[model samples]
Each structure stands twice: as structure tokens, then as C-alpha cells.
Target: MIPELAPAKACAAKVLIADDEPNIVVSLEFMMKREGFEVLVARDGRAALEAIRREHPRLVLLDATMPGMSGFDVCEAVRADADVRSTCIVMLTAKGRETDMARGVGAGADAYVTKPFSTRDLVQQVKDMLAKDTAARALATGSAGAGELPKDMPA
Candidate 1:
């Protein structure tokens, strides 16, 4: 009989989404939950920071502009934190300017996505970031068990 490959282990990852826009947060949270991710929502940058500090999510999706702190500030703050410095950060904004993208990168974001993003694309990006983060953590811990996919959301 031919040898069979083992299935890859599913990893549970938590993601925090920070966006002032209610619609955006709702839509994203729904999609992320559907994809088996534990999600936390923050309506503003300051709240995002607090959540990150308290929850230490595996990934952060930050809106570029918010009522306070801004995405840049949140990214900076997270990066400066020793506890969660390695968390993956993706910036989402309506402005797609090169300078804006640069600013996000300079502020320590792992990815930048435009506001009018395709739901498919956003979900894919989230998966990619979480996978990358899991790999990195696995390397650091020297264990395959980095964290199961999160529980499914209610129908």
C-alpha cells in the first residue's frame, strides 16, 4: 500500500479587529468567526490598544484612522510591548496611497489592505498572517503545538 501523508495540525488563533466603522467591524467579525477564528472587536484605536494589552491576540487588523491613537500609534504601542511584540498586524484603510502604505509598514504592520477590500481577499490575508505567526511561534517554542482551529460561530 502507498504511504499516506498525515493531515496538518489545525491551530487556533485569536484575532483582534480595530475599526471605528461599525459596518466594517461587523462584517469582518462575521467572516473571521466563520473561518474558525476567535475574534475581538475594538471600535477605536485606544480600545484596540487596551484589548491587545489585555488579550494578547495572535493578530491585529487595525484601521488607519480612528477617533484616538490612530492605527499607527496602536501599531507602535504594540510593537513596543515585549509581551506581544511578535503579534502580526495588518492595516486596513480607505486611503490606498503609497505614502499611507509606507507609513503603515514603517509603523510595524505586517500587511496593508485597502478599505474597499474583497471579503475573500481579507479572509485569505487573515489566514496567511495567522499561519505565518503560528510558524514563527512554533520555531520559537520548538513545539508543533503552538495553540485547534477556533470554535465555530453560532448560526
Candidate 2:
């Protein structure tokens, strides 16, 4: 008789949605949950930052304008903290101006996606970003295949 193999464990990736708008939060929460992500939410920037530090989510969908600290502030703080600096941040805001996008990137957000975004695109982007991050980490830890360099590295 053949021996049975145990199933591999799968850990769902955590995604934090930081937004003050109740409707937006509800939709995002539902979408993320449907996409198999473990969703965490914060209604304000302060709470968002607190959650980020405490929970260490794999990704953050940050709103630019919020009561208290502001998403830019939270992004900067996360980037400055070495322990959580690697956490991916995607600024999802109504502020669609080029200057605002620049500011988000300046503050260390991995991606800045304005509001009114396509949910399908957003989900794909998140998956791609997480995959890229995982690959980078694997390369940094020398677990990536022997002759391959991370995409960002010069040939």
C-alpha cells in the first residue's frame, strides 16, 4: 500500500486597508477577503500605523487623507523603521495629481494607486508586488536559484 502524504500548510497573506470612508473600507475588505487575503482595517491614520506596527501585515492599502497622521506620514514612518520597512505599501487615494503620486513615492510607498481603480487590476497588482517582494527576499537570503539575480540588480 502507498503511504499518504500530508497536505502542505498555506498561510494567507495579510493586507491592511487604511481608509476613513466606510463604504470604501467595506468594499475593499470584501474584495480582499474574497481574494484569499487576511484583511485588517484601520479607520484613521494613527490606528493604521498602530496596526502596521503591531500586526506587521504583508501589505498596506493606505488612504492619503485621513483624520490624524496622514498616509504619507505613516508610509514614511514604516520606511524608517528597519524592522517593518520591508512591508509593502500601496497608496490608494482620491488624490490623483502627479504631485501627490510623486509625494507618495518619495515617502517610500511601493505603489500609489488612485481611487476609482479597477478592482481586478488592483488585485493583480497586489499579487505581482507580493511575488516580486518574495523573490527579492529569496535572492537576498541566497535561497533563489544559483545563477539568478533579483530583477533590480544590474546585469
Clash pairs (backbone) in predicted model 1:
none
lDDT tens readout by residue for model 2, 17-52: 999999989988998888888899999999999999
Off-target runs (Cα >4 Å) in candidate 1 are: 1-11, 145-155
TM-score of each: 0.84, 0.88
The candidate that wins on TM-score is 2
Per residue, candidate 1 scores C-alpha lDDT tens digits across 16-69 of 999999999999999988888889999988999999999988889999999978
Q: State in Å the error of residue 4, model 2.
A: 4.2
Model 1: lDDT of residue 95: 78
